[model samples]
Target: MSATDWIHSFDRFDGRKGIKPGLERMEAMLLLLGQPHRDLRFVHVAGTNGKGSTCAFLASVLEQAGYRVGLYTSPYLSAFGDRMRIGGCNITDDALDALVDRVKPVVEEVAATVHGRPTEFEVITLLSILFYAQERVDFVVWETGLGGRLDATNVVTPLLSLITNVGRDHEAILGQGIERIAVEKAGIIKPGVPVLTTAKGVALDVIERTAREQGAPCYAADRDFSAKRTAYGLDGQSFDWRGIGDHHVALRIRLLGPHQIDNAALALAACVQLRRMGVAITGEAMQAGLKSAAWPGRLEIVSQSPLTLLDGAHNPEGAAALAAALKELLPNRRLIFVIGILADKAIPDVLAPLTELAAHVIVTRPDMDRAAQTSDVADAVRTLAPTTPVETMDRVSSALYRATVLAMEQRGAVICTGSLYMISEARAVLVP
Candidate 1:
């Protein structure tokens, strides 16, 4: 089948319509596909916020260290190809088509036999593992799609389990509180494997206990690995690692915000652990990889004429971090914001932090079924920032244009955030 045809076939497997627990189906499918996940070593990353960034950094560092790396991340910004990368390049269309075709019959059989209709994420993840194995990847960095325990990617027993940070996301599936979420994410920790985590607060306690209970060595952030910021600029932020040794190196990461510094440090710490496990990574390679790592839609600046910043700050914590970064970068200038969000998120919580930094806000919806209404988002912003002007637009492109015009007229900055889906849509329109 053609690539577009294969994608269209899987698109029908949406709406959380068919999801099952246990790895039996995945295991059977992999076995039929020659068990590709077993051909390479893995570093599985699971968390709410920083999993994509952390996976990108780790894979880049490994590649710099002279290993062929495969990186699998989720919720692609553009094409489905963005979800799978081999040696820093997306999988070729030919490879994708072959893998999808090979797995189609097996997926259909599983769906028929066990009443398991695999979701789009499940199908794509299985394809990634199979393709990575076929290519003989030296190392694979896998990010969990949702909660770690029943996540499709959890079938692999990774060399190291890394949890970047835990927050209240996907509450209906992962659980409501921070501790519960931590437990779900900690499910990736395999027995005798070292689990590295940057979680703090009650979540930290939960993760520590889970690691200990599972007989996994726990490397908690601040206790086993830590980072302290030394400097920050538009160029990037510089930080020193304490537990990993006196590696006084600077990074020129394209991703903005102080949170990225922490994310980079977490990836560095994971590298140190991998080296201790005999991965052969060097200090020079680590420096280069950290500086070169780029995860788009996380405070990505697309334009300089009116200074447009695109960030995927979908939740409250992320939104707060984005606001702080904008304030730090443009202390004297006001901001015009074009924002959109998913219907499931708490609109007030997501908009409150961003509204504090906005001179005016334009609300819009992403081209997704789950997107929140633009009018509702506008009303919420008005409730928070009564004096700030608010406008509602039907599409992200229109909202982005209006915000840019306003920013140019006022000599201010335009910030696009709220949902990754929205950021992806806006990026395609504005950047092009």
Candidate 2:
């Protein structure tokens, strides 16, 4: 099938969506594809936020150590192919087209046999596994798309499972409270496998209990491992890792925010655990990888003209982190905010911290089915920042353009945030 044809197939599949949780369909699909997931080793990552960053860090570190690495992440910042990377490069169009073609027939057969039409995410998950196996990846770092237990990517039995922090996002699907959400995220823990996590609060307790119940050795941050910030600047963050004993190293990451330092620590700890499991990673390689790793769209400064920043702060915790980073990085400058949020997210919680920093706010909806309308988001922003001027634009591009124009007029920086969907849309329009 052609690239357009595959895209059309996915568009068609997306129309039949429902939120049923199970690995049965994915299991069947992978089994039909000769269980590609089993042929490769993986470090499965799950959490409400920071999973992509953690996965990118792990992939970069493993690659720097001279291993062929495959990284599969979701909700790409720029392109569809960004979801599947081998040796730090996005999958080529020809390879993606071929994999889609190979999977189409089986998907059709499954649909006809069991009335099981796989969702767009499920198809992408299968393609990632096939591509990883075909490329003979030494290790594949997989990030769960949503709640972990029944996610399509959970079909793999990982070398080490890492949960990056859990918060009150996706409440409807995961559950109402932190403990319930942690249990769902903890679903990725497999028997006898080692799990590493940065989960805190009641969520941390739940994950620890789950790991213990599954007979998995658990390494919780601040206990088994930790990252302490030595210093942070607009350049990057510097932190020290304490898990590898004599292998302790002071590291700097290109990614911004103090939270990123914690993410770096999580990745380093996971790498050390993998090495202990007999993976051929050295201390020198870990240092190089930590320094070189870059995950875009988390506090990413896409342009200096009017000083535009883009962040995928879709949840309360992520938004708070972004707000703190903004306060530290651009202190005393009143920020012009371009905001977009999803229908399913906790808008009040996410926008609370962000509203305090805004000199003016422009609300827009991304071109996505799940996007919250601009007017509704604007109304919410009004409640948070009553004195801050708020306007609504139907298109993200128009909102971004207007924000740049306004910020330039006022000699202020523009912050575009609220959802990954918006950041992806804004990056497409603003960067190019």
Candidate 3:
């Protein structure tokens, strides 16, 4: 099958089977596929935010250590093929086409079962696992799509589990409160598989309890390891990571934000566990990997002169981090935003921090059906920052171009952000 044909068929299989979360369908599908994920070693990562960035660090560091690492992530910022990759390169189109064709029959077989048809995420999960197994990559840096417990990607038992942190993002799917959300995220913990996290307070308590219940030794940030930012700018961020058995004084990361430092610290801690598990991760490779790891569409500067940037800050916590990073990096500089947010997200909470820094906000809808109405977002912008100008645009490219022109006119920076869907469109328009 061609890429377009395969993608169309995959989308048809993506509908929700039932509201109640269970892994019956996923288990049935995998069993039909001959359980390909069993022979592979993975570092499963789950969290409310920072999962992609954390996965990037792990993949880069492992690759720097001369390992053929497969990295699997979700909600691709630029391309669908980006969901699965070994090191920085995506799987070839022909390979993906063939894999989809091969898996279609098995997916059909599962669709006929009592478990019913799997979602698009489930199909992608199966495809990625099969691809990794076929390639025989040394390790796979796996990220959960949503809450971990019933997520399609959670089917694999991993070598090390890393939860970046927990927050109240997916209230409808996961639960209402942070503690409940933490429990769902902590479901990635496996028996005797050492776990690491940057979570704190109630979230930390939940994860600790889960780890204890599973007999997985739990290591945490600020307790077992931590990152202290010494200096930061758009160029990159430099921090001091208190890693296991070593005091790494200066660790540099290309990814921006203080939150990124936390992610790097968590990944660094995971590296320590991998070493204990007999993976050869040298100090030199750790430093190199930490320095080289980059996650595009997250504070990625596509244009330097006009200072146009893109970030996937779809949730409140992520928005807060983006706001803080902007204040610290470009202090007092004017910011014009080209933003599109999903309808399911907390629009007010996502806008609150952003509107404070917005010299102007051009609201637009993303490519997804769940995207919030542009007018609704503009109303929220007015409520938050009444003085800030708001303009509604239907297309991400047009909104981004308009914002860029406005930013240049006002001598300000353009930040194109909100959902990954919007960022992906903006990236393809601007960078592609």
Strongest candidate by lDDT: 3
State the lDDT at 201 in candidate 3: 97
**lDDT agreement with native, every candidate:** 0.84, 0.87, 0.89
C-alpha RMSD for every candidate: 1.8, 1.8, 1.6
Model 1 pairs in collision: none
Report the C-alpha lDDT of model 2 over 261-331, residue by residue, as the tens digit: 87889999998998888888988899899889988898888888878888999999999999989988999
43 Cα displacement, candidate 2 (Å): 0.4
Worst 10 residues of 3 by lDDT: 11-20
Which is superior by lDDT, 1 or 3?
3
Give the per-residue lDDT of model 1 (tens digit) for 13-48: 246733455667787777777777776799999987
What would the TM-scores of all predictions be? 0.96, 0.96, 0.97
Q: Any runs in candidate 1 off by more than 4 Å, and if so which?
A: 11-22, 244-252
Name the Cα RMSD for model 3.
1.6
On a 0 to 1 TM-score scale, where does candidate 1 land against the true structure? 0.96
- Minimum summed lDDT over a 10-residue window in model 1 is located at 11-20
Clashes of each: 0, 0, 1
lDDT of 3: 0.89
Which stretches of model 2 miss by more than 4 angstroms?
A: 4-17, 244-247
